[model samples]
Target: MKTFCKFLLFITLITLYQCKEEKKTTIIKKKKLDTETSSVPEKKIVKAWDSLNRHNTEAFLTEFGKQNPETKVLIKTDFGNIKLRLYKDTPIHRANFIFLTKIKYFNTTVFYRVAKNFVIQGGNSDEMYTQKERNKYGNYLLKPEFRKNRRHKYGALAAAREWKRNPNKLSSPFEFYMVQKKSGAYHLDNEHTVFGEVISGFRTLEKISKVRVGVDEWPVDDVKMTIEILD
Candidate 1:
């Protein structure tokens, strides 16, 4: 009877040990399962929206402005670098420039229209890449954000607009210009939206304005430029 009891006790210990080993194995399997599950990439819900039109432009820019809080940009040119500061009050235009810079849109563009002593217009290029980029982004117009105080002072940054048939004076989102006139082109105060001003690099602006241009004011040698946001 004592021998039988000892055998039974041994059997009981063996069963308990097997159960403990099974529990450890189960735990290992669960951990491996969890790791495999975590390794699998989850489906991301991304917005594939197109064409920032009048309906969505304002809302898009408003959100974009909040995301990109950068107020300064550096325009890199063959001539020299021009530092600029975007105004917070002109949120829409400021956001637009910041967005364009972040996307590397200005890298493929050039100082297309340089009116000597007046303004140096840029962000348009002869390369098809420029048009392709514009198409990719959107063919949109910016509503006039004409602040009475934002005059076209020398080194002022403003948007290009069509004055021929545009009664509302909506600004062209793709192109922009900087006033080079020392006296200030105040006549364009209300017509064009002066969204920013050159903080430094007036010399660069001067050099760019002096570049020889054709009858249409397009530079003889394309004034290629790349604009980057400054922290």
Candidate 2:
């Protein structure tokens, strides 16, 4: 009987020991899983198109700085090097262009739209994957910072907007049109944001402006643009 009692005690102790080990293993596994989850932070995902409506000027300034903090850019166009001095006054617009240029955002992109003796527009690509590439970077729009001092003069690089639909809402974040004619885009002075000007490349711009185009003024042969920062 004593032997039987001793055997039962031994079995009980072994069972308890096994249970305790299993409980410890389970706790360890849960803790490991928790630690792994905590280590990886959830990234704030934002679409490029959605970024346009942001009302925060500081946020716009921050992203602009991330993309283009420089004060000058050299557009290596087919015509020649169009050295441009970004407006120090228009900080948001200037910074944004610098960012796009530094990253070669306009490389290989065709001057999609051109108006003879008027404006030359670039930043869209004929390549099928250009839109996808743009998506990967950002989708945001710039709130128009139209100043009276910034006129739509010849050689002025101005942001393009969906003006027909966006009455009084001047916001064109990605695209820009250069004033090619000497008469100046006076009609556009109060309408669009005139951000930068051709400090040294007005002549090169004139040459590109003369390039022949189709119905939409899209240059028959692509006019590729590469950019470099000076200051």
Candidate 3:
């Protein structure tokens, strides 16, 4: 009877130990699973402005234009707000402008280059944020979209290019100039990509053009600008 009782106790201990081991294994697995789930990063939504590579050609621009048919953008500045209507005919340039605006790429930029009585060039500044934003958007250029109808008239919004190295006259993705002179800059009609024109706030353009500038054409006082896509 004593031997049987001992045997029964040993068996119960063995069973209890096995059960405890199984429960511990289950807890470890659950912890590992919870940790793995918590560690997974959320998937980020890719924006059109993200990964703007040179490979994105006319087709991509066309698709983008198709998606966003509305052509207006509001340029907010300390001076005032200017409204611009992008030309559908210049699809590539228009699409590029729209993409930049949608991404808030022009925020905190400045009307850096102001040609007195001629043009007010913007979309750049000496600020660190400006450079950081530019670096975020890859270096890419748009082939000049010079339609016969798109002239560099007063309030004409056109892209600027590096004329020295850019023999092809591809426009700088980040810089644009607005014609502020009463007598239009007709000579630049076919030379630059005039994507949009100011529909309202011509006075603001004029005011920016008249701002005092130093030797390099940079405004003596910074005229910060923020752009938003209206439609």
Best by TM-score: 1
lDDT of 1 at 144: 94
**Would you list the rank order by TM-score, best first?**
1, 3, 2
Over 42-141, each residue of candidate 2 has an lDDT whose tens digit, in order, gives 7999855335334554475667676555777788876888877777777787777776665566775767887978898888886755675566445556
Candidates in order have lDDT scores of 0.90, 0.77, 0.86
Model 3 poorest 10 in a row by lDDT? 48-57
In angstroms, the error of model 3 at 219 is 0.8
* Better-scoring candidate (lDDT), 1 or 2: 1
List the pairs of residues colliding in candidate 3.
Answer: none
Return the clash pairs for model 2, or none: 48-138, 48-139, 48-140, 49-139, 51-140, 52-140, 52-141, 67-99, 68-98, 68-99
**After superposition, candidate 2 runs with Cα above 4 Å error:** 1-60, 63-68
Tell how far residue 133 is off in model 1, in angstroms: 1.6
lDDT of 3 by residue, 1-231 (tens): 999999999999999999999999999999999988786677988776465766775666778878978799999987899999999998989988888787777886889999888899999888887788777756678898889889988889999998787778999888999998889999997789899999999888877877889999998999999998888
If scored against the real structure, what TM-score would every candidate get? 0.78, 0.72, 0.77
Q: Give me the candidate number with maximum lDDT.
A: 1
| Model 1 misplaced regions, further than 4 Å | 1-51
